[model samples]
Target: MDIWISKIGYYFLNVGIVLVYGLLLGAFIAKTMARVQGRIGIPIYQPFIDILKTFTKRQAISHGIMFNLGPAFRLAGGLGTLAFIPVIYGNEMFSNFSAAGDLLLVMYFIFFGQLGMALGSGESGHPYAAMGIGRGLAQMTAYEVPFTLAVVAIFIQYDTSSITEIVAAQQGSIWNWTLFTNPLAVIAAMIAFLGMAAYPPFDVAMAPNEIPIGPPTEFHSHFLSMMQMNRAIFAGAKLILFMNLFFGGATGLIELVFKTWAIYMVAILVGAAFPRFRTEQAVRFFLGVPMLIGIASVLYIQYWAQ
Candidate 1:
């Protein structure tokens, strides 16, 4: 019982730390983009304020029961994803509940949240919601092709399904990291990450100008707040996951922040430089070069990896 309590305590602490870090990271990116474009941008603490205000306000509108449940389901998915993956590779306290096949579990949780959101939004009777869900799911499906292929390549190269073991394998040196060891998979995965990050050229699903903010168009007040919170948590969790898979996993919190921040910059910089793609264009883009790279990674692992 004591052990379970301690684990629960540690898990909450981990969540809190990542939550703050994720919010700040988003703010920093927003500020950076604003300055680059000659605007003052959002304050660093604005996300906290927005979340707090939303929760305190009354949500007078409700589409239905599933509408009420959508944000909760999304938040649960984020937490569920984080719960199973080791945060810091060597520290049991921060490791959460990682086990064999956790990588697969994390993937499922990632999809589950979006599916729940889709169902909820579908319940809302919003035409834009339905259109957004269709586009989002199609794009998601396209990106998942490359992302899953990259995962398969990693699994083939690492010869283990455990995320902890994958991190352990990368620990000896920087060169041992999959970024160096499996550049093909890294390239493929990073391309998918661009879409997963939901920035320019691939953000058609939630295009504010085009779709009025996608599936959550009807969600407001606490529902929006919960989704916002989950957004941060999910983003942070994905960064950590990618760090463990492609880069050397961090041994300490400082290292974790630095590595994840660096990984995030790839998306931010690319987003800054590119324009949005049409839904069809984005889908085709992922299915083209990124898909080919993913395939090559798998073939390389099978035929040449040592």
Candidate 2:
């Protein structure tokens, strides 16, 4: 009973982290991105506060009931991804039962959130939103292959499926850190991350002038607010996951928060300063550069000339 309770607690905690990261960092990303464009930044908590205000305000437009379920399950997907990562400080929230599952599970679970939102957007009856959503899906395809290869390289190098084991393997050693040993992986992952995070170069999905709100054209009130929160948490969580995997986990919450903040800053600044990519161009860039980088990571990991 005690063991079960602890696992439940950790699950909720992980879920909370996922949500907080999204709410805080999503706003931070938007603000920083704005700053890069020479605009004054908003408060870091702007998104959260905005969400609450929006929810309380009027006009909860529903494109259909289907749109409602998208955000609901989309959130579930994010929390589920975090829960499955198995890279928390010690054991995972679900490690007691499924140790074999690792990064693969994390990668797969994320699609749930992304795809759910995508479908919901298509149902929104907004042409711009549909166009953006379609482009976003295409963009996802462009990057996912290289990203998978980069992950495969890590799995091959470590020969393990457990994220905890992978982290432990790198413990107290600089050489073991994939970022140092596998710069190719770093490049590939960064490209994919930027794409996944949907920054300037890859934000065709929500191209402000083109798509407006993209899939969220009709979403307002609580639903839209939740969507904003989900985006924030997903980005922040990814920052932590990437850093912990490549750079090493922090000794505690403070270092963790601090490092993740720095990571988020880099991401947001880059997003803001850059211009949004043309859909075809963005896809080509990701497919080309990331594939090369991913292949290099595999070679370096497996047959580095050392």
Candidate 3:
């Protein structure tokens, strides 16, 4: 009973940490982008203020139960994904619920909230929302091919689907990190990471000008606040996952922050330099070069690495 209680407490603690720092990191990204464009950016604390104001708003209309639950589902997904990954190597305090599941479970949970959000959007009876979800889902399918292949290559090379074990294998030297040892797989995965970050070139799902902020077009007030919080947490979670898999897991909080932030900046830099891709263009791009690289990575690992 005590063990179970500790696990639950740790889960919440991890979620809290992610929420706070994630928002700060997101605000930093926004500020950086603004500066690059030669403008004075909002304060680093702007996200917190926006979220608070959103929660305090008086008017909120719900299309139905799913519309009401959509944000909750998205938030849950972010937290669930965070809970499954060990945050700090060999640190009991920050390991969270990672012992309860492996990499495959974490992968499935990554999509759980997305499917829920899609269903809720569908129930909202908004054509734009549905169209955005469809495009997002199609793009997701395109990227997952390469992402999955890259993951499979890592699993085969390491002979474990347990994330903790994978991290352990990469220790002892910087050269042991997958980014150095399996460059092909890392390249494929990082390309997919760009899409997962959902910036320009892959952000048609939430194109503010084109679809008026699709998927959550009907969401406002507290619902919007929850979605904002989820975005922060989910973005941080993805950064951590990449850091663990390719950069070598962090040994301490400071290292964790540095590694994740550096990786996050890569996505931001790419997003700033590129323009949005139509859904079909994004799909074809991923399926072509990224997919081929992913397959070749697996083959190289299986044949040459052996």
Candidate 4:
């Protein structure tokens, strides 16, 4: 029982960090995205406030049962990925939870969340909502080719995809960052993450003009509120997971947060700088340049970098 409590306690700490980190990073995107449009934005806590208000309100509006339950499952899925991902400091405490043979573990969990989000959105029964869901899934398919190649690059280097081992392999000094060692990976992963986060240029899934807020269109009031909160958390957690893959976790919480924030800021800047891509055009571009980068990273890692 004591062992069980300790395990639960360890997992809880990981959850708290990822959730709060996810929320704060999401707000940063909100502020930056809004600023790009020259509008004032809500406070960072606005997402949390929205969540609280949502929980207190009557849950009468969502069209389907899964639509109502989607946020809960999405939140659970997002937190679940934390168990599969290891932050540097928490590695010893959690131990082996991130064990795996290749990039498949990371890739699968990310896909799992995307699947749940799409399924939940589909249950909402709005036409535009369906459109947005379609866009996101289609976008998922478009970028996944390059995304998989990038993972292959890392697998070649570490000869493994166990998240904890990956972090362990990269310890000590910034140059050890996979970004530095495998320059092509840095570029490929950047493009992949942009699509993953649905930032501008690749923001086709929620393209406001194209589909009236994309897959999330039908959501409003409280149900919308949970979606908003989970979206924030999900994005941040994804960022940290990538950071772990390349930078291999940090020695301290402050260092980890700062690094993750820096990464988030880069995506935000890119989002602000580029105009949104047309849905089909977005798919083509990801499959184009980013796909090449992922391939190049693989060749460099497998043929020469070792």
- Model 4: lowest-lDDT 10 consecutive positions: 88-97
Q: Each model's C-alpha lDDT? A: 0.92, 0.73, 0.88, 0.75
Task: List the lowest-lDDT window of 10 residues for candidate 3.
Answer: 93-102
Per-residue CA lDDT of model 4 for 1-306, tens digit only, reads: 876677668777777666677877777778877887898998988767777786677755767887767666666666666666766545466442566753466577677766776777888888988888778888888888787888888888888878767777787777887878888987888788888877788887887777888777766667666676567667766777788887667767788888988888777788878998877887898889899889889998888876
- Candidate 4 lDDT score at position 192: 84
lDDT of candidate 4 at residue 278, scale 0 to 100:
76
Write the number of the candidate with greater TM-score, choosing between 3 and 4.
3
Worst lDDT 10-window in candidate 1: 54-63
lDDT of 1: 0.92
Taking all chains together, the TM-score of candidate 2 against the true structure is 0.88
Off by over 4 Å in 4: 29-41, 90-96, 220-222
How far does residue 29 in candidate 3 sit from its true spot (Å)?
A: 1.2
Q: Which of the two, 1 or 4, has more TM-score?
A: 1
How far off is residue 149 in model 4, in Å? Answer: 0.8
Error of 4 at 94 (Å): 6.3
User: Ranking by TM-score, best first?
Assistant: 1, 3, 4, 2
TM-score of 4: 0.89
- Candidate 2's C-alpha runs over 4 A off are 28-41, 86-88, 91-98
lDDT by residue (tens digit), candidate 1, 174-194: 999999999999999999999
